[model samples]
Target chain A: MSDLTLTPNIDGADDYYAELLAMHDGLSREESDALNARLVLVLSNHIGNRTVLSQALAAAALKPIK
Target chain B: MNQIFETPMYAYSRHADQDATTPPRHKVIVVGAGPVGLAAAIDLAQQGIEVVVIDDNDRVSTGSRAICFAKRPLEILDRLGCSAPMIDKGVLWNTGKVFFDKRQVYDFNLQEEGGHAFPAFINLQQYYLEKFLVDRVRELQAEGAPIDIRGRNKVSAVGTHPNHVTIEIDTPEGSYNLEADWLIACDGANSPLRAMLGKDFVGRVFEDNFLIADVVMEADFPSERWFWFDPPFNKGQSALLHKQPDGVWRIDLQLGWDIDKDHEKKPENVIPRLKAMLGDDVEFELEWVSIYTFQCRRMEQFRHNRVIFAGDAAHQVSPFGARGANSGLQDTDNLCWKLKLVINGDAPESLLDSYNTERVWGADENIQNSSRSTDFITPKSGMSRVLRDAVLDLSEKFEFARPLVNSGRLSVPCTYDGSPLNSADALDGPDRSRPGSACPDAPLTEGFLLPKLAGKFTLLTIDADAPDVIEEDGITVTRLALSLKNDPTLALKNRYLGEATSGVYLIRPDQHVAARRPSFDDKLFRAAIRRATGKE
Candidate 1:
């Protein structure tokens, strides 16, 4: 059984996002773009399992096309 | 071990007042006789303006400063009448192969499309480039062009007024004061004039420093760019190898932050490092070695009252993408035309505002690209490093990920997209010749489209009869025609007249597309020229 819940696991996601934006306060558009790419990759590698990673990727794409 | 370059002295410093014919005021006085200043002088002289350029040094750049000359710069240099020598002396390389560790990650080529005049990239020493430009300037001067280049004359103080600038210059002979209706500072990154003006270059200064070495050797290496991230010889760091003319190989090795530059640049240390990458089998001589810390920075504006800035004095970037000198060449290309128009009362003085705006956009783009390339080569933090490694690893296996790889996104002409100067394209024409973009050069029956356009507002009509040269409101527009007969491969037609077919384009003197319309309407074309000329 896979332990990937796809639920909001972090206690204070809002606080984290606020901190993220704050960290990105003075960064240029290019810097912000690089930061985001890195964040996604780094966070993904921390999650680290093939089945769990596939599940997360599929879940992320479940939203209606914007 | 310490091999210094032997530079020929052009003109020694002379007493400023020694010229009994010294005018109280010149049309434009350029500070710094480097490539940028010399190019600007030539452009201004072509417009029939008097220019006096003074430099602190009496020779060209000591080292091979900017080695990679991009195509757009070559075209601008062509107009200034000095591209042939560069092309002939340069090692033209259109392909670049990137590697990760011991494996070749991805390779890219710029020659996927041909038929244009110049190659995609030419690796030539900046010294030769400057020398050729200076020779052209001197030749034009001998032919009665009013461009004066004075060496060993340094600007000690700068005084800016509403209409003019007064500069105090210190020469070998003595000190003298000169006046200019307009002054351009091409004094390079460590510009004294920029300091005198009290403008700070605001941007990030990278922590890492790169050890640059130009070694001369008769090796059988092909003309190609070789870049490696964490190569075996230089473990955990990046290495770049580029070919230069005269059997010189320019090698740049990344030295991490907190490097003792003097210790590393010593020939004994540098030779061992070179031997590490290049086997002892190769007989190489150390030519020049220096350590540089890259900074992607620029002034908020390139124009300040009567003093405008072009090239390194206005902006600076890392040597990664080779945009440093290439973008400066573009600055002269962009500024000279507008300056000419304003000086001759052909365009409003407000036109100079576009130079500040457009070049700021250009500088931002260069800075962005340069910073990104630097980050990719030497990531900032742990997470960024992880992602960069992933990008490099994935680049080899997948075609999609290959585009994500940033091995110095080499220099390209900046399109003035979203520029207000553009007359919106109501007509659907080819995407290649979009308004506010540098028009693609095509081989015509004669030579090329760029040489044909030649320093004038051109109404380039394709597959249609061109209207006569229209001169109105202090603007003279030339009509240039191209048809299926002239271009056998349909390259020009395909490039300029795309979907919905034949169109007329309003081209600026700098060969940037001002506007494009599918239908031949004289009024719309003239209006485009007016907008491009800053009359609105």
Candidate 2:
């Protein structure tokens, strides 16, 4: 069982999105990629539960056309 | 072009001080006669303080600059007895529309909680604002108020001393020295006094230019603010359209950094840009045109010994939020009362420190907000631009995303939440009226609450009991007793007493809550008064 509720659970969602984008400013494309990877790893460690991590990963994955 | 700006309202005149053998020391000397400087002089004069206002220029500002005046400053001006003309002449507006590319994202109404005397905002040229303030000064003068405004009088040098400040003033005839117990520097953004004191504003200088075109035309456009982000007329840049009184419309177009500012301001170049924005079919005449580059900066300390800075001399911000002149008015509103108390020996000089504390906090808030708005309007990086566009794109559909659209969070009253003057809050009232916050206006059975409180230290008791007047440490706190029994609307109760059955609020002279309790306690009220007056 997974305990991940992803129904827009954040206040000021636009603020968060803008901050995330601003965090990448002045960084090279390769640096941004590495930064994103490191951020994923950091968040993964915080959510040590494998089931929730797998659920987040599955939800974030690109969807295919039917 | 209004001929009012050209008329020399305060033309050169020789004063008796210029010919005196010995320099006469003034109670308070204010430099600059712009809106902020005149406001400071008028406020001090109203408090029975002798104040002299000196300016290098003889007339009001030329252009239709600082077109937006928010409600808080209007209320302050009302208290100063000059809001009537401004409100009559200003274009009242509360609705603003935001656009992204060629489509409208959303329109917002600054839902002003009613029961206040003033509107949410007004668009009046800076010349009219200064002219009204100058007229009010004359009214005070006729009433024998100790206020004198000297035109063509400029302060060349300043010498700060222990008890007073010495200043060298230059007039049309010659130069003379004058002394003042206290000096107020409202000399504008490029403050000469700030420079003479060997101090400078320490903050960010935004790298962008904006062209302001004030057009005189009889248009059917509603009295509302219209902002465009990446419009068809100007690609990849922001633009603002605002209506002013007298059939004048203010248009601001963002120009990227590194451009020929002077060349861009030429009528040949400006007319074409205006034609692009407003189709060539529309008939209009260019009243005034200018280019401005803004910076968000302020002095580390607004007060330095006997010399205190106000208005643009103290801090400046980008014109996005309409914060510059509005916050400057707030600065004078905060300063005059404390200065009156200190000069009259009612409060300790340390009370002035709270002015420094609270206003610096206010300046930082204004700077931070305007800077954020600037960033959203002009993204520094490609990714930031993408994020900004995403917000705008989502705002077209999602209601939640609309709040993220920052078309310059307009100026509002600054609440001194963590101010030293604010005592502990013990009332379970609405957070809007919490300690250190400006008292939200509510209607009474007879009239509005703010006008009744006026500009005084008041003990506002709602459905509670307190004496008519309480004196503590040479300060008098008058009681404005109110009861919901008379108020049929329950607005006063809802605004002042939410969960609590009764409430007692000790409001400062500037109408900011100093301390509040569920009910009045004598000892606690006195202590709070002491704290607010800087005795504690």
> lDDT per model, in order?
0.83, 0.89
lDDT of 2: 0.89
In candidate 2, what are the lDDT values of residues B416-455, reduced to their tens digit?
9889898988988898889988887777778788887778
Q: Itemize residue pairs with steric clashes in candidate 2.
A: none
Q: Residue B260 of candidate 2: its Cα lDDT?
A: 100
Model 1 CAPRI rating: incorrect
Off by over 4 Å in 2: A1-22, A33-66
- Interface RMSD, all candidates in order, equals 12.7, 5.2
Q: Model 1: how far is B336 from its true place, Å? A: 0.8
What's the number of clashes in each of the models? 0, 0
Off by over 4 Å in 1: A1-66, B1-5, B13-23, B106-110
Model 1 pairs whose backbones collide: none
In the range B1-536, model 1's lDDT, one tens digit per residue, is: 32223564457646445464553688999998888999999999988889988898878887788999988999999898999999899997777899999999888776546778988778988988888988898898899999888888889999989999988888777777888999999999999999999987988999988899888886788878889999998888899999998889999999898778889988988998888888889899888888999789999889998999999999999988899889999999999999998998988999999999888999999987887778778877655566578667756654545555666777989989887789997667777678878988888887888898878888888876667688868988888877768986677877887665677888898899998877678777777778998987
RMSD of 2: 3.5
Task: Tell me each candidate's RMSD, in Å, in order.
Answer: 6.6, 3.5
